[model samples]
Target chain A: MNIHAISAIYRFEMNRMWRTMGQSIVSPVISTSLYFIVFGAAIGQQMGAIDGVSYGAFLVPGLVMLSLLTQSVSNAAFGIYFPKFTGTIYEILSAPVSAFEIVLGYVGAAATKSLILGIIIMLTATLFVDLKIAHPFWMLFFLVLTAMTFSLLGFIIGIWADGFDQLQIVPLLIITPLTFLGGSFYSIKMLPEFWQTVTLANPVLYLVSGFRWSFYEISDVSPQISIAMILVFLGICTGIVYWIFKTGYRIKS
Target chain B: MTDNADILIDIKNITKKYDNGFTALDDVNLQIKKGEIIALLGPNGAGKTTLISTVCGIITPTSGTISVGGLDTIKDYRDTRKMIGLVPQELTTDAFETVFDTVSFTRGLFGKPRNPAVIEKILKDLSLWDKKDNKLRELSGGMKRRVLIAKALSHEPDILFLDEPTAGVDVELRKDMWNVMRKLSQTGVTIILTTHYIEEAEEMADRIGVISKGRILLVEQTSELMRKLGHKEMLIEISEPLSALPASLSDFDLTLSDDRKLITYSYNASHEHPGITRLLKALIDADIRTTDISTKQSSLEDIFVNLVRDAA
Candidate 1:
């Protein structure tokens, strides 16, 4: 198991978050706060309610999902990439730790950071809107599952990226656009049938829809389908990670 | 000086072929004894690092087997890795970590329990105790190299591999590193280091192994290698200038100086009878008066250059 190695890598990574606390933790909180102020206060007054819930309240889960997806990926990607960039990965590779332990250490710490940020964003959202949770347990479950899934995606990205620009490509280009179009600011039902079908194809929609269902019992997709989609995504990411370790892909060679 | 039973690492016919059809190692074989210092000498791209990396399990060989202390590197990877500590060629450390924290963390990475006293002693041995709390980014290049050594030793492994430990370090620090290595050797830690510096191998290693073009050229005891391959030169300074060598000296492979005043004779020191007495008698019989006589023994540098040049 090499628990000490896991904890060592975990503690080392977690300590880096404290060193860059402003960028890692605070920037997302402040950015999400601004989203709340602009979307919940300025725009919600004119937009009215969504599915019998206030527009401000409806935006909470979506906004949190937006930040959660991007932050988790970026945090995990940069976590692994920086080690490769600096050549410190050799130390880890030569250690007594196995590949699974290394992944658990890096992915676990990154998810923990993103989860903390997700909770903070949720708390900050309460300041701008009156939020409700119809399924608190499911809400927590979805929060953790999404963080872990996206963190694993970020880990894969970290290993695949050969340069700094590539590290930002997925989070900025793909994830941000998907989250924006994933029912973050509005319901997918408002779109035409064609666009609704297109929006449903975006993976982020499943996450936001499932999380919104937990909060208000109003969702673009069924809760069970969303959970199933996320679980599949989680499984795929885990399989890729396993393959990476088995082949000694970027970390070893 | 150890016996066969003391062999700590056994690498047999290990070969590494990269994905791009390049063979980095070809049928390499070596046996390292415990508690002895061995230096692997080769030019850049000679696969010195690759061989060490394979034994450390960082890079898997395409074929063959490697066992450390009788534990197969692949089947018992954790146990094998636990027995080794490597100070890689690259200068990499966590920029934000205090020296103490990083060293302590590396020990834990090897699954070692907390032992502050041992860490303190290693820091003190490397003269890094004063900077224990300083961030690694704040240290100089030499101090960072020492920190790498401290990290490698933190786990208290049975074998340590140092890849070019003194490449960029200054003379004083190199000497300090040598002292630390000497101290470690006294404690029965087997040391294998790869280096381009010939003098480092000469000064520190008990055995020297030369590799060129992915093949092991030779591995021999330091003193024995010197005696076997080393050539000695006898320079005879004539009291009077001679335009040509005397007929009696025609049997020797001798050369005259450009100024025509010195006769130099080269002979293998390992020869049963070096024929020094015969050369002196020949000089006397020829009535070549000499003002000075001196001999020079070849150094490890000369032997290394010759070996590499021949291989090329």
Candidate 2:
């Protein structure tokens, strides 16, 4: 619970992002802008508003959550993987620093990046469409809860991966596909009945819908259900990660 | 066990067994005194690495106890870990980190503050100040090894474990590393190193331990061990070559050279000494004149091979 170690790791990760400003912060903003233009603004002008809200408004929260999820997971995975691939994990293991400190350091930094990217993507979406937060409390709550959950997921993935190729497989095959299928581009209401029910099974749908619910006050699923699901997912992922560090499974052995 | 000083490390009956049914270390007991640099010498698969890793808490022992600075390694990991720094054999370092940040980050891992003065002294001592800003990836292999040493010393630990610190290293850098170790020893750092190079122990260590088959065969002071078991080899090359030894040569147990041009005799450790006058008179009685003779003292290699071969 000491903030000193957390602060040190967070600042170090932030500095790495700053060094790659184009890729980490700017590229995400540019990509989010394009999504708004093609999927929200341009498409909306042709097909009309979605669910009584402006197309840009409907896409805003999903865009922010998408960036938050990808960046948070990838950042944490790389942070832990680099240390291992380069053999610096030995240094961390030999040091007096505890496993809890390492987990906090890596996950805390991942959360910080996710938070920043989420905020920046939100602001950039404003360039394409006028936006307002209908429930300020819901917006802030989901933003943090969502970031922390994915960051923990990232820590687990990082520890599980041994090499660079192993690290890329999870994000590319699992996380990205889940995000797209989770209704980031279209609502489940636009799908057939069976397909809509299947879409409900996607965990990422809960995150995007929960965050979108905060912005537009309308969702295909209940906001409480998605929020509770996220917390449950967070608990499971944290348990797995804490167990890995405590047992020193692959990390130490 | 010498009780001349406080016990820095008290390792009792430690054992390790891998899942593959290979017992890497077994029931090993050792008492290391404060400020002593113990050289653990053994051949390949001798459990030297496993012993060091267990003491440093990198690998957990299946049984037994290890205490450093009077704190049990398993029960009090944090306290014991804080007092020790291990420089592993593999040259794995942060390639992207500059020399300064790498060591400073290691110091911070121990919860030490960013004292530029202390960091500067460590860098300068390791001869890394001029290369402080250079990234690890840019440095040569030897330089990277030096950086690892500097990082291990940054936190000012009481016990330092080096697993093969100089294997495959060039001669000049190896000497440089020994000099640095010497300086650290002068500062009262308890150093334990595992090496395949037996001469390293003869040159630097006060006490040498030979381990084999996951067991400590013997632990003794360098000179004491040598004096107790060492001997001289007397190789005499005669002026005359003979196909076979005469009956008078029976007084001396000797082996004929491959070409029958010389005779080799082990002069000690057999509880017997060959009388040179008797052998010379016997050779003269046989009308075989000796031209040259020389004797060489036994080396650590002789002692190591003798000890391990006997134990095996």
Candidate 3:
């Protein structure tokens, strides 16, 4: 309800990102661009088109999701984590702002940053491969939902992590590997039948599949199931965050 | 105003027990009047910070309740929180933020509407106006502390808690902070400060509370505490060196200096006459000539140290 507090935290966090533009915005854009150059050009030639769509264009949705997922989690996690590390969180804790407002500010800003990067990467994809979104509205929906969900996950990681190593552990060891294995560069159908079944178990697969479905109308899984899975994940993250605030976990005591 | 309402902060039997079974606070009770400057003095880990944190809603107490303006801190958190501003002990600020932005942001965090004149006055009062546009990372430590003060005051709360506000500060800044506090007190803002320096309390606090080992040992008016518990000592320099005290002077609590030329007497300052005349008469009767005599009153530091030492 305290919109001013939320906006203050949001602006402060956004300002930090602006000050570190090279690390926050530029690095991710350039890295995703490299994925385009290496995966789209070099690897796309080796593999033929799948589902009548060129390999390079097919890689666009996956690459954007890959960056979106990783950046969302890391950005939100680091957003809250840095304040905890520097002890500035006390100022927030002692203020009149509620815990929900605090989360909204940090998570909202992180999601916005990740969403912007996702869009820029999408635009940059046009330079390498001719891509089209069959459903632009669905594409935007998936982008915002995925950004918010992962940003919530990042907020959890930020609170749960006690050190810098722990903060980076989830994004690096878990999110990145899962995103890569979830069909960022290749489709699940390309794997053996048994591996394909196992690959479906990865939650990142649903996210990427649903996002890819928006671009080419083709996915490893049904789009409806992917949306349902993301909503469920979002609910779980919201519940955990509520419990954290109620118990004052890592923040109060 | 009603009685309870006049009591700005009513802390009743508040206790905080950490999960590990360590009791950080034990049945601490205090009532702070509006517009009175109180100093909570204690050693590190004496629960000074815990008590303040509990009252401020940063840490919840395991038992009992705290009410600000008759509103429970937990049940009515937002309302009570809006009434308080806390300047924490740690010097924490966003390194990339400019002073004006950070201070303005803190005001917004309190859900207060923007008032440029108020912000400008606070900045000017804290002597931070010149550095308003500079990033926090570029400011000196003292300036950062001032910014903390400005942020706390930005909301214009009725009560302010300053936790070791002058720790590690220079002498000039310390004096300057004291002056600022005095000026604020004149505006009827109730200030409660926790400090390691007894001199700070002596200089500013209208009332003093001593907390040690999770218990509030004493809370008394500054003048009343000094009058009731303070001891005065008289040092008498004798014309002739004596190896032993005279039998007539044995009734007085006295100590001979190491050189044997000085006799020192300790007594309560508020007592009627303090028996100094009788002691001097005894000295004369005993043929112990006293060339010179001077008296010194014990400071709040002495009272604090003795109280803490005895409590331990």
Candidate 4:
């Protein structure tokens, strides 16, 4: 199992996070807080309620999801990518650790960081809007699942990227825009019928909808479908990761 | 080449061909006995690093097999890797990591429990204990190289591979590194090093392997290799200048200087009778007076160049 190896890698990564606390913890917290002030306080006061909930409270889950997805992807991606860039990856590659343990260490640390950030953002939301949780267990479940899934995607991106520009391509170009359009600022129901159909195709919609349903019990799609979609995404990412280790993809050769 | 029981690492018919069809190693075979220092000497792009990397399990061989301590390197890599430590050629390290933390990190990566006492001894041995808390970036290149050695030794492996450990290092530090390697060898750690420095191989290696063009030309005991391949030259300074060599000297391999006052005779050192006495008698019978006579033997550098040139 090489449990010691996993613990070493995990602790090394977590130490890096603490060393760069401003960028890892402080920056995300401040940015999400600003989103709350601008979207939940200043703007929500002028908007009407949706699904019998205040507009500010409705934005909580979506906003937290938005940060969780981006942070998870970036954190895990950069964690692996920097080692490759610096040529320190040889130590990891030549070590006795297995591919599974390597992934567990890197992805686990990334998910933990995102999980902490998600909780902090949720706590920060209490300062701006009245929050409620109808299904606290499901909310925690969705939080953990979403963090782990995205962190796996981030680990893949880290191995796949060959340059700094490529590292940012997925998070900045794809994830951030998808989160914005995935019902972060408003409900997809407000869209015209045709647009609502198109929004359902966005994968981020499933994540946000599932998470919001756990909070307000109001969702654009059924909660079961959201869980299924996420689990399916998790399966796909796991398959790719397995293939990566087997084939010695960008990480090996 | 010894009894299988004494062999610690056995590499047989190993070849590594890259995707682009470049053969980095071609049918290489080697057997390293336990606690012996073997040095692979070659020039740049000679597959020295590739050979070491393959044995260390960093690169998979395109064909053939390697076994360390009777365990197949590919099938039992975890067990094999636990027995080997490699100090890579490049000085790649985390600039933000402290010396103590980085060395400890390598021990853990090898699945060993944390032993501050062991790390302390290694750091102190490498003269890095005083700088344990200093970041890697704050250290000089020599210090960083020592830290790399400390990391390799942190796990207390049975075998250590040093790839150009003294490349670009100063002479004094190179000698210092040699002393450290000698100390480790005394502790029964089987050491294999790849180097471009011929003197390093001659000075430290018990056996020297000359590799060229992805192939090993020969591996022999350092002293045996010198005696077998090395040639000797005798310079005879004449008491008076001459226009040409005497007819009696035609049987010998001789060359005359431009001034015609000095003659040089080249002979194979491996010969039981090098004809030095006969040459002196011939010179006396020819009535050629000599002012002085001295002999010089070829260095390992000369033999290495000739071997590589012949392989090319």
* Most TM-score-accurate candidate: 4
As for lDDT, the candidate ahead, 1 or 3, is 1
**Model-by-model DockQ, in order:** 0.73, 0.46, 0.70, 0.79
Model 3 agreement with the true structure over A193-235: per-residue lDDT tens digits: 9999999899999988998999999999999998899899899
The TM-score obtained for chain B by all candidates, in the order given, is 0.83, 0.81, 0.83, 0.85
Alpha-carbon runs more than 4 Å astray in model 4 = B233-278, B286-297
What would the per-residue lDDT of candidate 3 be over residues B92-178, giving only the tens digit for each residue? 988988899989988988888878789999999888999999999999888888898899999899999999989889899899889
Clashes of 4: 0
Candidate 4 TM-score, true structure as reference: 0.92
Give Cα-based local distance difference scores for all models. Answer: 0.91, 0.83, 0.90, 0.93
Model 1 stretches astray by more than 4 angstroms = B1-3, B233-278, B282-298
The 10 consecutive residues of candidate 4 chain B with the worst lDDT sum are B222-231
Top-lDDT structure, candidate number: 4
Candidate 1 global Cα RMSD: 4.0
Listed per candidate, the RMSD to the true structure in angstroms reads: 4.0, 4.5, 4.2, 3.8
Which candidate should be chosen as best, given DockQ against the real structure? Answer: 4
**Residue B9 lDDT in model 1?**
96
Residue B80 lDDT (model 1): 93
What is the fnat score of candidate 4? 0.73
- The candidates' interface RMSDs, in order, read 1.0, 2.4, 1.0, 0.8
Chain A TM-score for each of the predictions: 0.98, 0.95, 0.98, 0.99
